[model samples]
Target: MDKHFEISLQNRKLLYSVLKDTPKDVLCSIPSGFKNNIWWNIGHTVTVQQGLLYGLSGLPYTMNMEVANKFKKGTVPEEVPTDEEIEAMKGLLFSTVEKAQTDYKAGKFKEYSPYETSAKVTLNTIEEAIIFNGFHEGIHLGTVLALLKAVHHPKAV
Candidate 1:
């Protein structure tokens, strides 16, 4: 596997552990001023990966349209997914990440949208998408950390 695919697989492992430890109640809770719950973060992190990989790579997405919209960019979990639905979505999230890395290593990307990085560089290759997944995963991971801290800090103290 390439470096990018290797990094992506490692990230998926870390992300899975984080999500596994997150309580359902905490996952559904909304931190102040945020439109999404932890549920959305979990699912969105996975969706964006697939979007960057499969959607752009010319492979079929394992997630259906209904689940995609529930977790896709722009649509918050509150507006589309019930708590139960969000839990179910979590399963799909884990599966897609695993599949995406395999697809990515196979060089199946389709060049759909032009993605720009946080560094302001625009990417037109699957290599860029693989690198970008780490960036995207880190962003969501930070959000999950904050959510856990906010909801569990008082108890911890």
Candidate 2:
């Protein structure tokens, strides 16, 4: 496996750990301090990855822009997205990752637009996007963990 995929998988594993035991209430509840609930964070990250990789690669994005805009960085979650929509987003997230693995192995990204890492650094290949995705994933995982801890008390002996 390429190093980018390896890193991306590691980040995915961490996200799985965080999501595995998250209470449904926590997933759906939007606390005053958090921008969105755990579910929204997960969906937004997955949506961004699919859009950047699939959409930029000339493949149709499984997620529509209206849903994407709901969780776009600057947008506030004024209303909660339905459970059905969240489930659909989750399905797309899984399938997109599988498709991306095949696309990367087959060198399908040769024609995609170049992605910049940040304003200061530019990425010229899909490999860079995968690596950047890992970094972005970790950031959201940290936020989820912190929120989980903040909202609930740690177990005591």
- Tell me, by TM-score, which candidate is best: 1
* lDDT top scorer: 1
lDDT of 1 at 123: 66
Model 2 per-residue lDDT tens digits across residues 1-157:
4676666656665555545455556666676677777777776677767766776677766567777777655555566556677556656556667778887788877666776544345655566667667677777777777667667724101
Q: Candidate 2, which ten residues in sequence have the lowest lDDT sum?
A: 148-157
**Residue 114 of candidate 1: its Cα lDDT?**
75
Superposed by TM-score, candidate 1 places the C-alpha of residue 30 at a distance from the truth, in angstroms, of: 0.9
Checking candidate 1 for backbone clashes, the offending pairs are 56-110, 57-109, 57-110
Candidate 1: minimum summed lDDT over ten consecutive residues — where? 148-157
